[model samples]
Target: MSVWDDLIGQEPLAHTLREAVAAARDRLSGGSGRGMTSAWLVTGPPGSGRSNAARAFAAALQCRDGGCGQCHDCHTALLGTHPNVTLVATDRLSIGVDSVRELVRSAALMPANGRWQVVVVEDADRLTEDSADALLKSLEEPSPRTVWMLCAPTAEDVLVTVRSRCRLLVLRTPSPPAITRMLVDRDGVPEVVAAFAARASQGHIGRARRLAHDEATRNRRREILRIPTSLIELGACMVAAANLHEVAQEEGQGVAATLDAKEVGDLEAIYGASARDGRARGYPGALSTLKKDQSKRRTRVVRDTIDGALIDLLSFYRDVLALQTGARTALVNDEVRADIDSLARRGSADSTLRRMEAVLKCREAIAANAAPLLALESMMLDLRV
Candidate 1:
């Protein structure tokens, strides 16, 4: 298997990256690196494998045999352990100026063992204004042997200045058939289960994998989709809002559990504060700062979870609209076709469009830091049948 094997339905992109790798190899072999780009901005929808592509490209550039997956160089490069590769993936809400400056410093170095010094930033969209500015000069005047690959959901999500200085690599969402095939072949999922997950995720690779394996995630999604059919009364709307909020909180907490505990324990040790000892002198402030960071992280996770639920709700209404309009496209929520038919019988296409608009508005409101429960309540009322 090559480094590009996991990049399903992206043969065009892999070909482009392979050409660049060949050019870089030419330079390493004392030829001009024509057609090779030193800076790259990888843009794609969520789960479209932007970071994965970047990692593959990085590994390929450093590999003599062009990312042969069996080699130690390929393994280490993919894992970000190769001496020539730097993977900047942050669990924090945003990348700061300090971190960007460190990367800038690293980008100034020559390659180890006469190869490329590769840097892959997994969340360029999360770079703060200051950090984005810090990254500008290095991108503009990168070292001859240094390569930078930055990933974001869309080109618009990244700073314009930063994006303009780099070559663009866009990834497309794989089709359901493609995704289903991959789940069965790679992850050894049952065909029926893989098909369901592929359709339900709407071609989101990561979510498809999760839904194929995790019963809890599927159950929660089912409950979320059930809201559209259950919003019969004003009281029911509020209840739905509360349930949505609770589910989002649980999702957020689930994501935070591992990293949060590790940080708390590390901070406690640093402050020398334990159950047996009294609070240390500077422990309170440090702990308070850590809590603030964790709160921001949790809020982001919660909002993202709710946003995902909102997207699912949109799909439900889309099915209803399709039925109402006598459209031929298959329902995204095929398992809920009966419910969708009932909704179609009860509402016109115009009403379905209005409800979808309301859902989109609710997503925007929550993204703007509005109270999630309040936004959800407003949306649920609008979605009432």
Candidate 2:
């Protein structure tokens, strides 16, 4: 119904935000009796809607009626066109000092709309040390009328100094039933499909959405889940590994290419528009900066894709091991029960557990800065008899 309702399965966070709204409202009515808190840090796992929570909170702060969906302030805030609400979102790998400096300058200004001047940084984990230090200085002496909300995967992501100064909001991953209900209620997906996506995604909201919306994503997941039963030979394992890598890379590229092109196009237009009469001596430096940023973004996109695929791969082996040991709990790949059953029958529980270990080791190698191709190849080889 309302924007707040769209933040699925975060009841505690919703309650806390509502309280903040009430506090701010009370302060407004009583001539700053207790005053508003200057900063908030919202943290959660990937795909858990931490940024969305911050946006909803911003809407609440802007709304005279505390996030009334029909009000002008709520509407503008939600659409990201509000005069006082600033949201910093980036697809780039890191937030550099320049961008953070710009935000710091904006933070110094008073609210044009006479409400809270809210600044929401969506990916605070990507802020470099310099950016974080700049942000810390701003937070130390925040304007009386300003509010800063930062979202990251965990408190450890930001500097301890920064984290210590902010109110913390921890969001839990939504349950499968909650995800399934949302899919059926919001997206009009079929019951079976919603349940399948919900179970397979393991509380990842974006992945569940993709599994429901994209036939290809679901099909690829199904194909990956079948790898355990299909790995009958050494060559088959390598082929499967290569296929997984390519699929992940393709998906990552698909996600990044358009954004990358748009960013480069915008940068070029800015430079080219000002490059009149062949006086653009700094164009090369600008072009180089753009290229470097693009390359970093590509790496981040690939890493994200690989992370998703790794989860899918991990779930399949986990399901296999679960079935082999008769865990009696629900499987992550419940939609592919038949395939899991077949794999369980073909391999002993110990062997399946070993395969799961190999998968985990592959993940560790990647995290430890090993080449993904070589690490994955070795993991696949280890999975063979």
Candidate 3:
């Protein structure tokens, strides 16, 4: 399949990018072109395939047949192993200055095996101010053979200086029908399951796929949805809050366990601190630093897990509000329509909106580093019917 095959419901944007790829090929062949740029800023909401678009564009730039996905260049670029392609992605809280400087250094090089030296930054919004400044210099004096693609949630999420120096491409969130079709057709998911996942995920393709394929994910979501109905009293609210926090912690630990083990093993190998060798000279400081970084990463993973659960909770309340208001749009949690109707009948529209506001506030509180249990307790109390 072509690189664009997985980019569901984005034909217009794909066409534009493909045209640019063709024009770049023409320019490389000593022909004039107008649709290409040295730097591009791709903006879309979460799970709207911003990074996918950037990666596809990178592959197209490297492909001899302008992204004939079967070619070696296309495969390597898509996998991020292309000699001329540099992909900067971070799992940390921020992309620091040192990382940006390394990216800038890479951007200065000419293409080794392709017409363009493509650099794709998957989380441009995560760039610290200092790193952004470093990136701005490279954008200002871009190498002729180098191309940069920066992806973020929105243009406003990036610095004005950085956004201004690049061409803008915006992607729309795919509709539920579109997402459903993709899940069923591409992933071979059952139709009923795909529909539920598509509605529940709210246009997040990756989330939809997970909800369709992973029973554990669906169970966690079911637990989250049950929280609203379970918050019948102060004691129950506290219990629900604790349960939610525990679930988030469990999910976070599951995600971090393998990565943490690998990181520890790598550090141990680097410092020769295995069981046989014990600690090498100067290993203590390095080990401490590694642990500190891992701690921060674990904290981030927990917060992210909580944030996702909050989003699911928010969608549940939103469904209740929609039912209360007699809105015509499809419910995000349509699979739980009976429960939603029961909850809607139990509360007024304003109260449901208030619950949503509480969810948002809890999200903000956790983002501000408030204790998760405390923030969730307050939210659950507010959600009580």
lDDT by residue (tens digit), candidate 3, 220-252: 999888888878889999998888888778877
Candidate ranking under lDDT, highest first, comes to 1, 3, 2
Q: Model 2 over residues 27-146: C-alpha lDDT tens digits?
A: 767655353577999999988888889888899998888887778888888877888999998878779999999999998798887778999999988889888888997787898778
What lDDT score belongs to each candidate, Candidate 1 first?
0.91, 0.83, 0.88
Off by over 4 Å in 1: 267-288
Q: What is the lDDT of residue 269 in candidate 1?
A: 77
Reference-based lDDT, residue 224, model 3: 86
- Candidate 2 differs from the real structure by a C-alpha RMSD in angstroms, to one decimal, of 2.4
Estimate the lDDT of model 2: 0.83
Per-candidate TM-scores read 0.94, 0.91, 0.95
- Give model 2's TM-score versus the native structure: 0.91
Which candidate comes out best when scored by lDDT? 1
Model 3, CA-based lDDT: 0.88
